[model samples]
Target: MDEVVNAIADPVRREILALLRERPRTVSDIASRFTISRPAISRHLRVLRESGLVHDELVGRQRLYTLDTAPLTGLAEWITFLRSPAGWQHRLDALETEVRRTSRERSTTPDSTAPKENTA
Candidate 1:
């Protein structure tokens, strides 16, 4: 569970994992998607690989990277544990996540029926 949490903590690493979901990609290919240099991307990938969320294979001169879902098994178990009636923390966290997402979506679009506040 610690590995899963750490692996997902960084937005860049998460994006890298998302890219690996579609298919294997070379290090350079993954680096091209972001503004960071290849070495920075390598560090992120290293964390992911150490966390068991990704695997790499040497294909000629380039390394091919792919997603490894095995670590997710532990995450699923953790989620199940967190969803139990005794786990109020998880419930609150889930609610907070939903609220944030809803607020973000609402902020992007105008609600025609809503009243405008005038502080004059």
Candidate 2:
């Protein structure tokens, strides 16, 4: 999970993942899309592969890289959990409780600026 997060942290690697999501492509094919050198792209691919976010296969002397979404399932799950009603409700409830507690405390506390009653 850490590896996947680290790998996708880079802009180039995210773009590479997007490309692979569309379809598998050879190293040269991916390299041609960007101004960066093939070696740079290769290094990015290596990171993606090591992270288990992508897989490669050699065909006709060309290595084709493809997206492997299994590793991404954890990330997706985390995102879904964050977006769920329960998650927001928990946070909102905590906030509401704090607000109510503060309001109560303020009401109970006397205002020091209030005018005092004079006894003739």
Candidate 3:
């Protein structure tokens, strides 16, 4: 998950991922989208490669980068866990609703055990 987050943290890297998600692109092709130098794009590719977010293959003289997409499994798992019924936010909301319901019930129902106080 850390790798996935780190890979996506950079806007350039995210753009690269978005591009490669559609189709594999050459380093030069990827570099062309940015105003940064080719070397700078190479550095981003290195980070993406290390993060397992991308993979490269040499096709003849050109290196083609493709999205690996395996590292995203951890991210998806985390999102799924957060969206599940066991998540804290959902539990807190439910607890709050129950408390409000109980409060409303108490407000509406007069206490039978206590003596009624006279209103001025």
Candidate 4:
């Protein structure tokens, strides 16, 4: 999970993933799309592969890279949990209960009013 997060942190790596989503490409093919050196692109691909976001296969002398997408399932699930209605409802209910308790306490307590000054 940490590896996935770290790999996706870079814009270049994200672009590489986007390209893989369309179709698999060799290291040379991916490198040609950007201004960076092939070595740099290779490094990015290495991170993506290590993170389980991508997989590669050797076709003859060339290695083609493709998106794996399985590691992303956990990230999707976490986002879904945060966006759930029940999660928000629980928080709102707790806030409402606290507000009601405070109001009740205020109403039950005797007022601490200052004495009024007598008029001349």
Clashes of each: 0, 0, 0, 0
Residue 73 CA error for candidate 1 (Å)?
A: 1.0
Per-residue lDDT of candidate 3, residues 48-115 (tens digit): 99999999999999999999988999899999987787767788989999999999999999889898
Please give, for residues 1-120, the per-residue lDDT of candidate 2 as tens digits. Answer: 789999999999999999999999999999999999999999999999999999999999999999999998998899988787685688998999999999999899998899999988
- The clash tally of candidate 2 reads 0
Look at candidate 2 and give me any clashing residue pairs. none
Query: In candidate 1, which residue ranges exceed 4 Å CA deviation?
Result: 87-120
Error of 4 at 25 (Å): 0.4
Residue 28 of model 4 has an lDDT of: 91
Q: Point out where model 3 deviates above 4 Å.
A: 87-120
Tens-digit lDDT track of model 1 for 22-92: 99999999999999999999999999999989999999999999999899998888898777757677799
Model 4: per-residue Cα lDDT over 1-108, one tens digit each: 678889999999999999999999999989999999999999999999999999999999999999999998888888888777685698998999999999999899
* Pairs of colliding residues, candidate 3: none
Q: Which candidate ranks first by TM-score, i.e. highest? A: 4
lDDT of 4 at 27: 98
Error of 3 at 98 (Å): 15
Worst 10 residues of 4 by lDDT: 79-88
